[model samples]
Target chain A: MNSTIALFLLQDGVINGAIYALLGVTLVLIFAVTRVIFVPQGEFAAWGALTLASLESGATPGTALLLVVLGVSAAVVETIRERASMRPARLGVMAVRDVAMPIALLLIVSTIAPTKPALWLSVLLTLALVVPLGPLVYRLAFQPIADATVLTLFIAAIGVHFAMIGLGLIFFGAEGFRNEPFIAGVFPLGPLMFKGQSLVILAATAALLAALWFFFEHSMLGKALRATAINRLGARLVGIPTRATGRIAFALAAAIGALSGTLIGSLTTISYDSGFIISLKGFVAAIAAGLASYPVTVVAAIGVGVLESFAAFFASAYKEVIVFSLIIPLLIWRSLVTAHHDEEEE
Target chain B: MRQSIRIALLSGGVCLVGTTTLAQVNVGITVSQTGPAAALGIPQKNSVAQLPKEIAGQKVDYVVLDDATDPTKAVANARKMIAENKIDYLIGSSATPATMALVDVAAETKTPYCAMVPSKAVVDPVDEKRKWTFKAPQNDAIMAESLAEHMAANGVKSVAFLGFTDGYGQGWLEEVEKAMPAKGIKITAVERFQRTDTSVTGQVLKILASSPDAVLIAASGTVAVMPQKTIKEQGYNKPIYQTHGVGTMDFVRVGGKDVDGTVFPAGPVVVADLLPDSHPSKKVGLEYIKAYEANNKTPFAVFGAHLADCMSIAANSVKPALEKGKPGTAEFRSGLRDAIETTKELPATHGVYNYSPTDHAGLDNRSRVLIKIVNGKWTLLP
Candidate 1:
């Protein structure tokens, strides 16, 4: 390929890689904090994109209803599990956060959705609808099995993935959706045209990375999350509240996933099941980082994107095979480099 | 006591005859109701509710099952339906792999099978196993020929190909490879992408770099929009041609302005409203579309029409098949197969079927029409 074509491919790869990097970082974060593989992380992205599409089309997204349903279930599960320690104030907080909040959000969305609110409002509403779902999912699925083996948590995460996919189908139907890009122009740079949305995605990724760095390096809650990721029992001993930190990590992952979905929704057509494959690429990047280093995950995700783009160009039929096969060599190198550790006795 | 025993035997014999004449015809259906192919399967499942409840004065009981786009589950569903439901006819698994998986079971059970997918491999050559199988959708070869002819007539010399890596894509590619070469149209570039791929930019860039006169995308459903949109965004203004796999409105809806001028070969039913009254499929197509739209309260997808055509073909074959034997008998199954083979000029939504022992796809050039998306609407191309 010529320089111009190569440049175009690089630009395309970087844009996609940005999204994958965001997802990869979130996957790493969630896995580190919760000891769950978080397979349903992609589902939130799909839900975000679809919810935005529905709002644009002047219909209250079915995800609002789903949020209420999940919230109620999470509330019920949490209450029963903590019934012994539950106080009047805690019950009141649970009732408001889990039950009343979702109901109010549903009401607001249904009322404002028909008017086809502005893009920013729609996006904010989409996030509001999807972000809480992460914590709710943790409460309902993972928290119950918090002390279970990683294998069990991974299976539970897959179960949640299927459930979310099913719910996505019910909410979005089978039709795929694409949202209008936030910015609608192209910039020509040295014989290569960059789409406005691609730039937006790159900028957003950088900004999010900076925000995450600041959060972890400076913020108290972020330090607590880092501590939890380092040692759950130690963090609990230091009064960090491992459960709360886990929930916070999920919320952060959910937010990142939702934002990534919004960015991706403008770039391509997204269906209910689209997130799985996209997130799968991110998973590859995470695995390449040995599922630990965020900076390495970002770099690896970009590398994966570039590799995928080139692979598609060189061998279109084997694009997915080529991309997925990277994991094999990565695993080999990882095993060769890293020392294996036995599972810590619970 | 002897007279009473004689009377009881006589009544028993009459009751057996009564049940035999009024036996129900069980038709089992399996479709991908909740998986990747759900977009196609849901419509087919909906159309099942619109199928004829009674054919030739015999009650037709349809046992619908969800394969979830899994071929293994499709086989299991087929086996269960045959063993427990005692299905006389089987209509399957909305996708190619799942549909293909049911062929052996249909052959082994000596039952007639109807496949909703367009892959010619499902019924071509009509082997011992395939002879029992019939497909509803027009073969890829037929549509490919039409597409090649259109490209040639429009003075397109070279084309680029982009499609799914699945059977649908491979099937269309094989047909296009054959049809294009025969029309003296060269395929300059060939690319493949997965149905769930989020981006096809690299593939599109490569296709554009080849700079052919046209690009032909062989993907189906909403996924088809990705390559077209990516190509368009890259500023490739050449004519983009799609296959009948994208006949549904969802393709147009998802592709939007990028797909506006896209030329594709689709079933006549997709543009039934635009077809002249003289067209054989026009009346039936309109009728089916009306019934489906009224029931579903949405625009009728062309995929559903395939199942409707299958139902009509089966319904048309029932009368002659019933003349041979009872509904649940093997004689009836073979009779139905033979009758389906002899089907002639039977108009359905997609086309007029004329099946024969040598040809199980049962469609012709008349089954396909050239369509263009104009202003986000499907317009029949003259």
Candidate 2:
């Protein structure tokens, strides 16, 4: 009974699972609000981590906390601007206004936001950077590219993906970057549990999802966002600023991506290259449901993570094969189910 | 250029007066200089780049080509070096398959191909079937033999072997088979999988099912790190043995604390004390380590540095004969072959690389080390 091997696999699942899940959540949210899947989500993670790596080193706990506060503030502002603008808020005029700044800020902040920020501050800074991203994406990349064609939008995202990776390599250099874990050391629980910085990833993910659920379900802004997502014309007819709402969702989703990135940076040894893999996994997770939405995406990420964990334990070599092989059959099954459901409804 | 041609015409006329002119030997060096392989390529490139500088006194003209690590590309590149570049002796094709591709090209050109394949595929493919190709670098079979010795010294008996199904993995597997039996060890279990497969817990469970004294792992990159974590959590008390690929800090960091107590069989770390100052290899090994660290802007890697070392030693053997005025493909090949075999005076970073036509990998049992990963640090085993 090599419990350590089992524990290792179990812990890996939980840690990577949380990161994937949050990223999947952001992708889902953006898709939900805008009806377009965003592929640039991993850039937010890389950007957030790079931001933290720059600022999080050698700071006092108090200073770190202060950085986190400032980060949260930035995130709020970003969210408002992005989510509000997505409703085609100035009748397509402010489409430029809605998404441009957040994207620029994400790029700039991650690369040059200064180092030596406090540890807690590093994490906060990352979250703050991401908070507005979800909403921002809806306004900038999705909205403009949305009308062109699906292929164009997908291509645009792939281009963005390449651009982001190239930028990280050029700016960060092709080296694995480091960040000290916010907490160190592990507490083992019998044969099956782990307590360390990695476990904290799950806690953070839960908090993010809970926040999203609250905002989307209970808040006034949330209801407006849902209206905008359902039908821009109807929302506008009902006096909702659909354009503005879409922008805000873009900002919010972008922010979530950034926060996930930051959390990932805090927990793992990240290279600038880590983003693409994260992006790949996140993108796959988002589309886990044929249509990108939260219900299927989060489940997909968790499912993949669990599979990987089990693979790591039993056949680390075969884990990826298991993941890819599982997807093909799943897609077929999903198509069959969708067709059956459609027939039943008809 | 025209003016130099006139001078060369005059020199040729005078040289015609001098013993009907001496023969010329063409030499070629192959290394990876670009693409993903550039991680090891640049060093290989530099070794080729520096060969001419070292051959300043020799009469040999040389060519350098990039392997790029693709077997198809390597063959094309090697063929171009032979047919187009007019090189007589061929060295390198970074990976085993790449080297194997060059075997036919080398045979057609009648050029002797010497290579550095840490993977076992290079030698296993050559056997009685091919005689023109020789290996210069350490092979996985030899490495397995080394590892088997390590296991025996540590009082290990029953063991489980886990490896990827690729050439690198299978090569080590074959070598372990060769060496383990002599050590009186029984391989209780053997597990295999494709490199890209992410989960290995089932194979690990199967390996652990045998209740062996140790587990041998031969893998590289992400493939190397995943299993250590599984082994850690599954609570295996017996030491896990890894090949050279896992002997790096990447394994320790990626494996995290999960690999803290594992043992990986390796050769000398070019940066470390294994090559003492008194050893003839100290200066050359240290210099390459320094140059690679400076060029790559980092510390040393045992694998990359060893490749760099091979390039230097190969150049040393070929360069002088190339200069002795018999600078043709045949003379250069014969020269390199003779120099490599007869060169007992020079020292190699790995060991005294007295390579011969019969002994492609000129190594003995003394050429290895066992390193342990303990508390996230690489330490030599006691």
Candidate 3:
């Protein structure tokens, strides 16, 4: 292509790549700390985007009800798990944290979101409501199987993905929603015209990346999470709470998903089931990173996005094929390089 | 009381005359009520449910099944309806692929099927495999001609084509090319994408680079909104056109301001209120709108109206066949097929259908009306 066409393709690819990078980082985070692939990461984005759309339309989103259900179930599972040695004070605290807090948040969102708060504020509220779901899902579906084989954990993650997709359908219906862009205007940079939403996506990705860096570099909890990621058994023996670390990692992943969703909400139409495709692309990027190395995963995701953009310009019908074909070679390289190890029986 | 007595006497006389006479006309319908096409298929189901309960003094037993928009399931559903339910006629399948599969089942079983999809492949070529098949929706060829004419009239010299990479999209592309060349309109870009694709930015940018006078998107349902929104966001200020596949409330609701001024061709049901009173389809279209709104609590979708037209066609045949023989017999099925094949100037919803042995979808220009989306509402274009 000529210089101007190449420039536009680059712009489109970078904007899409930024979102994929956010998702790739989230996938890597969940896989590193927890042995699960976190297949439902895309659902968080769908829920986030759909919730924002509902709030914008001055309607109370069904995510409020989903939060309430997930919260109650999480609390119930926790209670049953700890019932044999339960302290009354700890039980009460757990109930307040798991059940009462989500219900209160749901009530607050229902009241404020319908009054049509500022778009940014509503988006923040949607993130708050959706981010907790990641940890709640972990407690309900994954924590009990924490000691299981990686294969079993992967199967459980797939089950969670299906359940979330069904729940998403129930909440959002089959109709698709498109959110209003957070920013409106276009800027010409050199030979390319840059969309305002594209800038928002870049800004959000950078901000979240910096925040994650600070959290991992300075904070005590962040250090604990790092320890858990490095060696779960060793960290547990040394007094790091592995369960809490899993929750923190899942929560961060969910936050990243919600942020990514909000950033891209206005750029495309989102339905209840749009998450799987978006997450699959991110998964490809994560695999390229070997499910580790946050910076590399981000760069790989942007590469996938730009490649897809150019592919679409050249062969639009085979663009998906071109993007997905990257995985075959990557998989081959990984199989050739990484050493295989069988899991030991506990 | 008089109507009830007349019906009772008529049934009593028929029963006294012969037990082998036609008892009921069973119609088996398969629609995509739960998948990607549910927005269109659900309304088709609702309209089929509203079919007249009795045809030709015989009770009509209708069984509706959800194919989930899958071609395999659609074939399975058709087989079940034919073998187990012993249906006399089959009406089915909102999406094109499912209808194509169901048509195969109908042909194999020697049972007549009325397909609700718009692809000309359903009834074209007039081979033995398609002898028992009929379609209710206007063919893609007719709609494409209308689009080409509308674009040409609006001074569009060149156009870009972006459509779904499926039967629906390919059908529109073929038909639009056939008509555009005749209208002296050059097609600048031809792009395709899947229905579930997350973005069409690359295709939209390419279309912009080509700088066509207009763009015609040949996608259906909610998926159509993506490219339209992308084109608008990218600041392509020119005429934009869509196909009849997008005549749904969800398209309007999802597209919002981005779809404003999008020109396309649609069936009369979408703008039933806008048709002049002297128009042949105005009254029938309004009647369908009333029945649909009463049941669905929304305006009638063109797919639903197509099914309504099919029901009318089926009803016209069943009344004549019941006078001849029983519904489940081969003779009765043949009679029904013949009746549907001979459909002539039958004024129902969508348009006045005129079917012949050579032309199964015998709709002319009367079946299509040029429409534009103005302020999130369908408006007729003179």
Q: Estimate each model's TM-score.
A: 0.96, 0.72, 0.91
Residue range with the least summed lDDT across 10 consecutive positions in model 3 chain A: A337-346
Q: Candidate 3, after superposition: displacement of residue B354 in Å?
A: 1.7
Model 3: residue B278 alpha-carbon error in angstroms: 2.4
The candidate that wins on lDDT is 1
Model 3, which residues run further than 4 Å from truth? A73-103, A343-346, B1-22, B233-235, B328-331
Candidate 1 at A226: error in angstroms?
A: 0.7
Instruction: Please give the lDDT score for candidate 2.
Output: 0.62
For candidate 2, what is the DockQ-based docking class? incorrect
Q: Rank the candidates by lDDT, best first.
A: 1, 3, 2
**TM-score: which is higher, 1 or 2?**
1
Q: Is candidate 2 or candidate 3 better by TM-score?
A: 3
Residue pairs with colliding backbones in model 1 are: none
Candidate 1 lDDT tens digits, A182-232: 999889888999888998999999999999999999999999999998888
Give the per-residue lDDT digits (tens) of candidate 2, residues B121-237.
Answer: 554444443445666556666678777878888899988888877777777777888789988999998787554333455677778878999998887653476666556656787
lDDT of the candidates, in the order given: 0.89, 0.62, 0.85
lDDT of 1 at A252: 93
How would you order the candidates by TM-score, starting with the best?
Answer: 1, 3, 2
